[model samples]
Target: MPYALTCTLHLRRQVQLLSILTVFSVIKAGHVTREGEVRWQLFNECSQGMLQTYLGRVNTRGFSDRHCLTEFHVEADFYGAIRLQHAQSRKYLCFNKRQRITLRFNGDSERCYFYERINHSGYSELESAWQPRLFLGFNGRGRFQSPDTYHVKRRCFYWLKFVRYVPEEELHHCEIRKPVDQHVRLEHTNMAHNALRNSLLNQIRATHDGPYKHQDQENRNGTYSL
Candidate 1:
């Protein structure tokens, strides 16, 4: 073989190896820390809402009166595989055989696992670990939809933000005390529920002056259920 041809072949092999490494690098960039279990609110990037689990069903909502349904226990591995369990219901978020996202009590099954693919901007795409090709995404109507497309508009549905979950009591305390650094206002998010609860409690305390006085006391002591 000619020396020039041999050199050309070597260069091509190097280029092919580099391309393979680049693809791996992109996948590795999404690796989540294998630390202890953490709580998170799955914030959808396109829908601009949080993922909620209710009665073994899954959907994204702008705001919900039941805030606990929006929180999930995130157990992530080094390779980005995760298991999300609803904090309130203790149900595992699973992708069913029917290609739908659902919740079940048994979390040990393979269907409960999801592989996280986070991008440079900290947005994550959760692909089903049972079927890696299928992604946990949402439709335009903010309903759960497992996307099977390889390269067509995946970000609009699959991309999400794993926001650290903060308890409503702490948020409410900060708002009541009027913290200087933190701006306190209710928008179309989870915190809005707290604000509404407070408003209802205040109304109960002010309007009920007769037989409901005991209920007013409970409201003042923060034991009120609205």
Candidate 2:
């Protein structure tokens, strides 16, 4: 074979391999589905609790705690960017100047957005869109990835799994919700976790005060959407 032809073929092969890698990267960087009212429940394995909003502060709470507060309406575009709004307060999640995750009434701010990346282990990590270096994690906690740090086998605290939470009353809309499972599942077998997260938030207290009063009223009217 001519030397020139051999060189051309080698370059062409490299180009093809690059194209394939690019496509695979796009596939792995999954995007958020915009199906209406499809909420996502964020569970932190280390904390063993669900991420919930309370009085505009973000924290993890046990499953038996304020249930609706744990659910969030995630809005996203085709590029894997997401914004989370508390299911009850309708408040969007945002990071303050101090890097603390808090709730805000407006979702338009850049601080409210996050870029989600799913690890090969099938768990997901959320990094702030406004401040790329910072990630969502427990307040005053979270290790930042850096050149000096060595990767470890244990899961990082910032890594959290999103579980789909659908109320039994919405069973009629199951078909509409199916499309989002692929992104939420990410090849991880969390059937038991899903079952526990999907349990209805039926234990809301009657004497619940503060923000609970507003949510309780909305629940009673059965008009709450998202």
* Most lDDT-accurate candidate: 1
| TM-score to true structure, per model | 0.51, 0.49
**Compared with the true structure, what per-residue lDDT tens digits does model 1 show for residues 43-132?**
676566778876556877645434576767666556557788777677889978887878888987788998766444445677788986
Q: After superposition, how far is residue 106 of candidate 2 from its true place, in Å?
A: 0.5
Per-residue error at 60 for model 1, in Å?
A: 0.7
Whole-model Cα lDDT of every candidate shown, in order: 0.63, 0.59
Return the TM-score for candidate 2, rounded to 2 decimals: 0.49
In candidate 2, position 68 carries an lDDT of: 73
Question: Which consecutive 10 residues in model 2 have the weakest lDDT in total?
Answer: 141-150
Writing each residue's lDDT as its tens digit, candidate 2 over 42-115 gives: 77655667777765566665363445767776677566678887777778988777766677888888889998
- What lDDT is reached at residue 171 by model 2? 23
Query: Number of backbone collisions per candidate, in order?
Result: 0, 0
Off by over 4 Å in 2: 1-36, 64-66, 139-156, 159-162, 165-226
